[model samples]
Target: MADQQTLQKMRQLVDQLNEYNYHYYALDNPQVPDGEYDRLYDELTALEAATGTWLPDSPTRRVGTEPVSAFESHQHLAPLWSLDKVKTEEELINWETRLHRQLGDLANDSLEYMLEYKYDGLTINLTYENGLLVQAATRGNGETGEAILAQVKTIGAVPLSIPYQGTLEVQGEGVMRLSIFEAYNKTAQEPLKNPRNGAAGALRNLNPQVTASRRLDLFCYQVGYCSDREFESHEAMLAFLRENRFPVSPHLRKAAGIEAVAREIRQMEAGIPQLDVLVDGVVVKLNRYDLRQEAGFTMKFPRWAVAFKFEAMEVTTRLEDVVWQVGRTGKLTPAAELTPVEVGGVTVRRATLNNFDDIQRKGLQKDCLVWLRRSNDVIPEIMGVADEPDAACSPIEKPHHCPACGSEVVEKGAHLFCPNTLACKPQLVAGLAHYAGRDAMDIDGFSEKTAALLFDALDLRSIHQLYRLKLEALLPLEGFQQKKAENLMQAIEASKHRSLSRFLYALGIPNVGKRTAGDLADHYGSLERVMAATTEELVALPEIGAIVAESITTFFGEERVREAIDALLQSGVTPESAEESPPHEATAFTGKTVVVTGKLSTFTRQEIKETLAALGARVTDSVSVKTDILLYGEDAGSKLTKAQKLIESGKRSDLLLMDEAAFRRLLSE
Candidate 1:
C-alpha cells in the first residue's frame, strides 16, 4: 500500500497538472515548459497505476475514454430557467416595473445590474465536488439534463480541478472561437454553419475524440449552485469565479440603474464587431441575489433577468459570379458565387439561387449588390438585390445546355434539367456521392473524388458498381492504403443490410426525401409494396400528392432505375422491414377498414396504424364508404362528419363510430 504522504503528494501533482493544462489550453500561455508538465503527468500516471487507483478529476482523463452509447440523464442541483427577452428599451422598463411590483417594500430605489453579451452557444451545467470537476450536463429541460462528462472534460477552459472545495454547479456556454470555426471549415468536407453549431454538435457527439478535435472553447456566465460559497451580490460571485481561474467575460459590467444599463447596452452593441464569437444580445441580470430570491421566477423564465436581443444579422454583398451545378437527378441549379463576406460571424462565399425562374423573377445580375441575411433559422442567403444593375452587370440567363457536359437542357416545372443522366459526369458523381452519404448507405471512405476516380478509371457508372469494388483497384489510388481499402470494402458490404426506408431514400428517387421515404415504408410496410404501388394508391395516402405520385411512378418506370435496383438486390442488398406480432386481442380489429380522426390521449395516429396492422386491419388516412369503423378522439372534424354521412347513407352498412374510450376498452379484450 502507498503511504499517506505519497497519496497527498499525488493529489498535489494532479492539481498542478490540471493548472498546467488550463494555462496551455485555455490561456494559451504556459507557465512551465512542455517537458515539465509531461514529467509531472507521467509521474502521476505511474503512481496512480502502482496504487491501483484512479482520480475522477485527473488531467489524464482529458485524453478521454471509450465512446458512450448514449448520454446518461442527470437531475440538476438547481433549475436553469431561461431569461425573458425584450427587443426594445420600453419592454425593459416594463419588466423593471414588474420586478419592482413583485419586490414591493423590499425593492431598492436603485438596483445594480450585471450586463454581459448573450452568447450564441450551447448551455452547459458543470458540477464540482471538493475542487474537482465531477459531472457536466446540458441545460436540457432545465430540471434534468444529459451527462456529457466525457465531451465537457475535453474543453480546456472548463477547469478539471479548481482552488475551492465547494460543491458548486456552474452554468456556462460551450463555444467555438470564430477563427477555429473558419479554419475547421476550410478543411472539413462537410462544413459547419457557425461556431455555435460546431460547439453544440461537438459537445453532443458520441465520440469524445470528435469533440476534442473540434477545439471547443467556453465562457462561464452564472453560478447556478454553490454550497460553502456565498456572496452578497452577483458581481461578487463572478469575481470569485474569475479568481478561481474561470474565464468570466471581461465585457461584463455592473450598472447602478436602468439608465446605466441602457448606456452599457449601447456600448455592447458598438463593441460587437470587435468581439470574438457570435453575440446576438446583451443579458441584464439583477446584481443583488437577495432581490432575485424575492422576485423569483415564472414557469419558464427568470423574473430578475432579461435578454435584449439584437435584430437579425444582415449585410450587402456583390454577386461576383453565378455557376450552374447539376444535382443527382440532373436538375441544373444556379448558385451565387460571392467575394467572401461575414454574416453572423460565418464566412459566406456561396448560396443557392433556388432555381432559374427565381433568378429571372428577381432580375438578379452579376456585379449587383444583394441584401444577404440570416433569417428564420436558415443559412445566410441573398434576400434580394439592393442596388440597380449597372451597364457592365449581366443578368444570369437560363442555360440552354448542361454546364458539365455541354448536353442539351430542358425546363422541368420551375427548374432546368440536363436530361443527360447516361453521360453527365456531375449527375453520375453526385448520385454516387449521395448513395455513399451518411444518411444513405453510409460508406465511410468513399468521397466525391473517389467516386469520380472509380467512374473514370473502372467504368463505374451506377450505385451497384460500389459493391463490386475490390482491394486491388483501390490500392493504386493516391491516398489509399491496405487498411483504408479494406475499411471501405467492409463499409460498402455493411450497407447492404440497411432498413427499407434507408434503401428507398438512398435510391435518390424524385420527390422522395428522407421523411417521405420513411412515411412510404411505414404505410406500405415493405419495400415490395412501395415498388409495386400504383399512382392512385400512392396519391390516396396522407401527405403524398399527385405530383409526388407521378414522380414515384416516373422514376420506377425508367429501365435504368429498375435495373439499378435489381442489380443492388442481386448484390445482396437485402432491404429489411420491421414487423411486429399482434397482441392476444389481435382479432378484435381484424379484417376491418378502420379510419382514425382527431387527437387521441391514448394513442398516436402512427401507433393506431401499427396496432391495426398487427391485427390484420386496413388503416386508411381518410374516411370513406369502404371504411367499416370510424374512431374519433377529441376534436373530431370534417372526417367525422364524412364518416357519419357514409354511415347514415348505408354506404358503410356495419360502420361502428366510436371514441378513444371505446377503442381502448376494445383493446383491453
Candidate 2:
C-alpha cells in the first residue's frame, strides 16, 4: 500500500494529466508540452505499478485493452428519436405554420427557436451513473444499442467522470475531424472515402485500439434523461452540458422569428467549409421545454423540431446493374450502373460500390433504389439502400473471375484481384496510361488507345519495354508518321530524367498516391533508399501507417518489380532527387478562405487551386459569408455576382474582390 504522501502525489498527477488532455484534445489548445506530460504520466504509471492500484478516473485507462469478441446490446434509459427533415425555405415555413396551428390558443404568443448544426456522423448515447461514465452505445434503434463503453473510453475528450451525482443519458455525435481525416488518408491502406464512415467504422471496430487511432471527438447536444435535474429551455440544457465539461458546439443560436431562423440557416450553410467536421444541415428546435412538451411527439419524430437540410447532395436512384472494372493493379472494383438522376446540379449515372464487402455491408441489390451522394466533385458513391428491394430485385453477384482477362480471381482482404498480371489487357492499358499522365511523367499524347495499340501490335508487355521502342517499329503503327514518331521518341526520352517523386507515383504502388509518393521521395531522397527501406523505417515517418509500410516493403521485395526497376535504370532512366524548398511562410492568402471565379489567362483551374492550397489557402467552390477573397478573371460568373450582393448587403463587409493583377501583386508582396 502507498503512503498518504505518495497517494496524494498520484492524485495530483492524475488531475493534472486529465486537465492537460481536456485542453489539448477537447479544446485544441495544449496546456503542457508533450515531454512534460509524458514525465507526469510516467510518474503516475510508476506509482500505480508500485501500489498495484489506480484511480477510477486515471488517464492510463485510455491506452486501451485487448480486442473484444463482440459488443453486447445495451438498452438505453431513454429512447433516442429521429428528426424530421425539410429541404426548402417554403417547407420550413409550412413546418412553422403547423407549429403555430398546433399551439392554437398560444398562436399569437412569441415563440423562440434554438438552432444547431446537424452533424453528419454516428450518433452516440452515453449513460452516466453517480458521476461516473457507466455505459456508452450507438443510437442503434433508439431503444437498444451495441455497448461500446470500452471504445468510447479511448476518446480523450469524453469525460470519464462528471460533477453530477445522479444518473444521466447524454446524446452526442461521434465525428472525425476533416484535418485528421486527410492526414489518416495519406497512408491508410484502404483510405476512408468519407469522414462519417471513418468515425462510424472506428467506433464499431472490435479492437478499441482501432477506435483510439481515429481520434474521434464527441459534441454533446442533448440530455436524454437526467434523474436529478430538469432544464427550463434548450439553452439551459446546453449550459448544463458546458458546466459538466462536455464538448459542446460554439455555434448555437437562438432566434425569435421564422425569418431570423432562416437567416441563421443560410449563414450556417455558408460557413460549412470553416468547420472541422461534416455537417449536413441546421437543426431547429423549440427553445422552451414547456413548449416542447405542449407540441408533443409524432410516431417517429418530435413535433417541436425539424432538420433544415441543405440542397440534396444525396438522391435515390435505381441501381440498374453492377459492373466489375479492373484497375492497373488488377484489383476488381464494383461499379453501379444507375438510372440517371441529378445530384448537386450534375447528372449521375454511376457510383462506386468499393468492394464485395462494401456491397454486403450496405445490403445493396440490383433494381433497388439506393441513395447516391456526390461531394467535392469526386465520383458519386452509394451511401446505402433508401428503400426495401422488391421481388424483382436480385442480389449483386460477386465475380469469381476477372471480367477483362477471364482469369480466376484471388481474394485479398476485402477485394478481388486478377493473378494474370502480364496477360491482363485492362491492367496493362491502365498502368501505361497512369505512367504517362501529366501528374506522373508529363508524357504527351500517350492516351489509353495508344497504350492498347502498343500492347496489341508491338507485344509491349512491360513498362520498361517503352524505352526499347525504335522509330522503325513505331512507323509501322497506325497513328505514327515520321514527325509524330520522332516527337513520341523525344517525349519518352525526356521522361527518363523526371523527378523521383513522379517516378514513384508512376510505379503504381498500392495505397500510394501522389502525396504519399512525394513524402516517400522527400524522406528517402533516392529510389534505392526507398526500395531498401525497412517497414520500421517507413512506419517511423508521420504520414506512413503500418499497412502502408507493409505495402511499400512488399512491393519492393517482389522479384518482378525489382527486375522491372533494374531494366528501366539500365535503359538510361535517371530520376532526379526532390529539390529542397524553403518552409512555407504566412502570406495574405494563408489560413484564409478563397474562391476563384471565371477563366484565367495565366493559370488553369487546377493550377490556381493547387497554388492557393500550397500557400495555405482553403479554396472552396462557392461564395460564402466566411469567404475572405474572391479572385476573379475573364468573364466572371454567378459567384462574382453573389459576392457583390453579399458585399452590397453588408453581410460580408471584409470580403475582398481581387482581379488577376491584384492577386499577382499580393503574391509578390
Candidate 3:
C-alpha cells in the first residue's frame, strides 16, 4: 500500500489529468503539451495497476473490462427490442408467414408496420416529472445504467421542459452524424473512432459543460409509460411523444406491410449522408398495440421489432502513400493514397487519417495492408492495419513544416497548424473559393477547379481581385470563352447588392453559421453596425454567446480581413440592409407557433416557412402544445393525428386543416 503522501500526490495527479482530458477531449482545446499529458496518464495507469484500488471515475474504465467482441449483455426494461433480421425479399416473406402461423386467423386482420431509421448511437431512457426532465440513464446491463441526466440535458434538441404536465418515460437513441462527428473530432483534439464512439463519449460525460460542447442530438422513438395518455399503435406513440415536445426521428414512416417497410428502408439507406443524423439500420415495428402485446418479450429482446442492419462496408486495401493537405484554417490533414478497392458499391482509393495522432495510433506505415470501411456508409476511413508486417514498409511521419508556406508546424491539440496564416497559398485559395460559393456570392462560373486555375495562372491572391479581372486577361487563359468570362464578371457585379445576412455568412467567421448570421443581421439591421459592435455588445444580443462574439470581433480585428472588406467595398460590392416593412395587423395566427407537415400542393415547405416567418409566427420543425396550429396538407402523416389529438384533448384551441386550394387562398389573405 502507498503512504499517505504518495496517495495524496496520486489523487492530485488524477484530478489534474482528468481536468486536462476533459478540456482536450470535450472542449477540443488543451493548455498542456502532448508529452506532459501522456506522462501524467502513464503515471495514473501505473499507480492504479499497482494499488489495485481503481476509482470508478477513472478514465481507464472508459474501455470496459469485458471485451465487447460480440454484443454486450443488456437487460432491457421491455426486453431490449431487436427486429427479425431479413436480407432478401424471400426472407421477408418467410417472416410474414411465420407471423401468420403464430397469430393464426388474427394475422389475416389488417396489419401495418412502422418503419424508422435505426439510429446509430447509445440507447437511453428519459424520465420526466410534470413535463420537466428529471433523469436520463443509459441501457447498461439492461436493468440499471449510469445516470447521465446532466450530460443529456446539455443536448439542445432534448427539451428540459415539455408542453404536457404529466409523468412520462421516453426511450430514444442519441445519434451523431458523420459530419458532426468529424467537426467535433476536429475541435476535440482527439480523433473519435466513429459516430458510435463519439456519441457514447458525449453521453457518458460527467460534466454537462463537456457534453454541451459536443452538440449531440436525440430522437425519441418509444414511450415506456405515460400517465395522461395511451397510444394504440407504435406510430401513435411516436406522434404523442412529438406532441409532448420530444425530439423524435424525422424519417419515421408508417408502411402498410413488409414491402412498404422494405422500400422505406432502401430509400433511407440511399440517403444516409443527406440526413442530419446517422442511422446504421432500419427498425420495423408492429404498429398495433394488441399485436405487440401478443408477440411479447423474450428474456433479452422483444419479439415485435427487428433491426435490419445494413451490410458492413469493409475491404482490404494497400496503403500506397500518405499525403498532407492544408485546409482553409491552415490545419494539416493527412489522406491515405490506397490501391483502388470497392466498398459499399463505390470505388474507394482515398481515406482520411483524421489527424497526426490518428496516423500514429493506427501504427500505419507506407505499403501497409489496411482495412478500410465507410463510417455510417459515408466517409471512408482506415479501420486497422494488417497483422503481418510489410518488411519494405516505412513508418509515416508528419511534416515538421507546412508544405504550402514552408513554415515550421506548431502542435495545437490534435492538429498540426501552419501559423504562417497569411503566407499560405492554399488558405487564401480556399477562402476565395468559399467567398465565391453558391450560398455566398453565387458566382456562376466559379468552380473549385476554375478557382485554382485563376489563383495559379492569373496571380489572383484575394477575393477582391476577382472583380478587377479584365476580359482581355481572362480571354487569354486556356478554355476561357468570351461569353463565360463576361457572365462571370456580371455575376460578381450583381453580388454587390446582396443582403446583409448573405454578406455576414460569406465572411466565414468561426461559429457564425447561417442561422446565427440571419439572427445577427436581423438584430443589427446593417453590416456596418455589426462591424462597429464590441464583443461585449455582440454577446449581449439574444442567443449570441461569448464564443461567437469573440470570433466575430477577432475576424473584424484582423488587418487582412479589414483590407479585403475595404477592397471589396471599393470594388462596388456593397451589402445593403433590406428595408423593414410595417408590421401586419394582428391576425388569428399572430404570436403563435405552427408546424406544416406532408405533401403541400399549393406552396413548397420553404414558401410556407417564409410566409409564417413574415406573419410573426414561429415556425417550428415539430408539433407540441406550444404549437398553436398544425396546417395539414395531403397525406400529413403522424403529425396531423397528433395535432388532432391535442385539439380533441382541449390542450390547444387552434388546429387548422387545409387542402391545396384553401391553403393558397389563406396565403393570399
Candidate 4:
C-alpha cells in the first residue's frame, strides 16, 4: 500500500532541505532565496500531510506535532542541581557571607569568580563516548531525565562527533536565536508563545526532523563528567572546550568578588539591547575547580555558584479584575486579571498581587491601569497601578467567608486563611493535582476537572482513594468510553509500582523537593526505612539539616498522613524499592589520565575504543600538561615525539609510559 512516488518526493525534498540548511546555517551561504525556499517547504509539507509519511531527516518535521503519551526517563550520571538565586544586592551579600563562613581560612581575601550570562532556556545533559554523541537528556527532577538524542543531534551548535576519543558529559542550555525565533513566528500559521518555550518545545518535540528544522543552538557551560582530561581551573576547562570547537560565551570573565561580579552583570545587562537572544541573569561561580569540589552542594544548588536574577521586564497593561485563589495549604492569595498584554514576548493575562495587604496598599481596582513585570522568571508580577489615583472603581474587600467552602475566613498577620483545607474546592483540587503531577505519581490525563468530579461524586478525599477508582464508576462521567475507562484504570494501577523516591516526593513533605527526596531515598534505602527514621537519624544524614528533619518527622506524625498510607496499602499500592541505574564504565584507564601516542598493531581504532567503553578509561590523543599515562604502540610517531618533549618538561614530571601488556591485563580484569 506504500506509495513509491510519494516516498521518492519526500526523499528529494529532504535532500534539498538538507542542502539549504547546510548553506544557510553551516556555511552562512544561501543558494536559494527566502520566497523560493518557503514555496518548496510548503509543497513538501502538503505532500507529506497527504500521505502521513515522514522520514527521520525530513525538513517538515521542524514544525513538530503532538506530544507522546509519556516521556521515557533516563537516569543521569550525576545530579543536575540548580543555582542559588538572589534578586537583590543585600541577598547577594548574605550569600557571600555564607560562602565565607564555609570557606573560613580558605577564603583568599577576595577569590576570583567567573561571570557568565544565565540563559532562560531548558537545561540539557549531552553525553559523548569514543568521540560520538550517544545520549542527550532533559534535567527532569535533576537525577532522572527524558532522552532526546535524536532531537539534540540536529542542533547546529552540537557536534555529532568530536576529535577527543574519551567519555564526556556536558551540560548546556538550549536556546533560540532572536532573529530565527522572530522569523519563524512571522511565517508560522500558529506562532510560538515565547523564546524559551519555543526552544524547549522544539527539543521535546517527538519528531527529530522538526527539531532539526528549528535550528536551535546549544550554549554548553559545565562539564558534568569528563575522563582522560584534567584542567587546573574552570577557565582552563572552558579553554579546552573551546579548543574542541564547542560553542562558549565570548563574554566570559573573571571578577574579584561580589562587587566586581555585580559590575560585570551591569555591563552584561546594559549590552542586552545589542544582543539577539534573551538572558535572565548572570551566574557567579568560583574560578578554581578544586575549590568547587570542597564547596560541594546543598540539597538544591552548588555552594560555589550563585545566580543574580534581574528585575522583571516591565510593561503596562489594563487590570481587568482581581481574583483570590486558595492554595493547597488553604492560604488565600490575590492575582490580577489583565487585558492580555504581551510582556517580554510572552502573553501575560494575569499577575500575582501577593496578598490582600498588597492590593490594599496599591489601592488596586477593576479597570485600573497596572504595570506588569515579567522578569527572568516564568510568572509575571503586577508591580503597581500605572494610572494616577487608579481607575474609578470600588476597592476590593476581604471576604467574611472562604470563597471555596463557605467556611469562616481567619485573618493572619497580613494574609487570609481557610480552615477547611480538605473540603475547599481549590485546595482539594490543587492537592490532588500536585499528588498526580508529572514529578510525583506521573498519572496521565488527570486534570483538575477530573479531580473535582471524582471528589464530588465518589467522595475521593484521600490519595489512596485514587487507586480505588473503578471502571464501572468512571462510565457514569460526562466523557467516558470503554477504551478510555480501561486506559485510566490501567494508568492508575501502574502508578502503584513507582519508585520509593517518587512516592516520598508525592507525599508532599514540607521543604522536600525532588532532589531532597532522592537524598532521603539514597540514605534510607527504602520507603519503610524512611518512615522508621527518627528526627535524630534524619538530622545526621548529609544535607538533612535540623529544619528538614523536623518537617519530615512532623509530616509522618500526622494522623491524616498515616491514614492515607494505610488506605493506599489496602488498595494494593506498594512502591518499588529504590534502585539506581547501572553505572557506565566509559574507559579502561581508571585512576590515570591516558594519552595514546602512536599507532597500535594489536587493536584497530574502533575495536580499542569499543573495549574502552566497557571499562573506566580516560583516553585522549593530545599529549599535553596533565596526561598521567602515555601508551606508545607499534608504528607510533608524532604523538610519541610530543610525549617525549612533555616528559622532559618538569610540569608533567609524574607522567609514566607503560607497556601494552598492562592494557591487556586491564582487559582481562
The top-ranked prediction according to TM-score is 3
lDDT of 4 by residue, 1-669 (tens): 229987887888888987776554323333544334656777786787788777876654431122232455677787777776777778888898898888888888788899988886678898877666667888765677777876787788987667877888889999987777775543232345456667887888765645655679888898888887877788998987887778887778898988877778888887775666778788999999888877888645789999887765777788878787777767777778889987666688987666777787776778878777664334565656777653376567777788777899898778788988667877777678777878788888887678888888888887778987889999988787888888888888888888888888888787676667887886677777888889998875534667789999998988877887878878887877656547765454554557654446576555666556455455543456667777776545455666778878776777777656777876677
Each model's lDDT: 0.78, 0.82, 0.72, 0.73
Report RMSD (Å) for each prediction in the order shown: 20.9, 20.8, 13.5, 24.2
Residue 348 C-alpha lDDT in model 2:
90
Q: Per-residue lDDT of 1-669 in model 3, one digit per residue for the tens?
A: 766776787788867877776555434334344435656767886887787756555655442122122222332333224344555666666776667566666765446888888887777788766555656777653454566766787688888767776877788888777677776654332456567667777777643555666678888888876777877988778777878888887787787777777788788789876776666678778888888787766433566777676765667889999999887777888989999988767788888877878788788889989878775555677866865656988889879999888999999788898888665888777777677776667777787677788888998888778889888888888888999888887887888888888888787787675567887888789877888889988876534668889999998998878888899999888887878878877865676767776666555556778987777777765566667777776667567888888889987756665455665677678
Clashes of 3: 6
Output the TM-score of candidate 4.
Answer: 0.45
Which wins on TM-score, candidate 3 or candidate 4? 3
Candidate 3 segments exceeding 4 Å error: 1-117, 121-279, 375-377, 388-390, 519-542, 578-669
| Candidate 1 accuracy as lDDT | 0.78
Off by over 4 Å in 2: 1-70, 104-109, 182-186, 191-193, 315-351, 356-372, 375-379, 383-409, 418-669
- Which prediction has the highest lDDT against the true structure? 2
Candidate 3: minimum summed lDDT over ten consecutive residues — where?
63-72
Weakest ten-residue segment in model 1 by summed lDDT: 60-69
Off by over 4 Å in 1: 1-107, 110-307, 342-347, 374-379, 515-529, 540-543, 577-588, 591-628, 633-655, 660-669
- lDDT per residue as tens, model 2, 339-444: 9998767799988667898898888999998878765344677877888888989999989999998999999888899998888998888788888888788788
TM-score of each: 0.56, 0.47, 0.60, 0.45
Model 4, global lDDT: 0.73
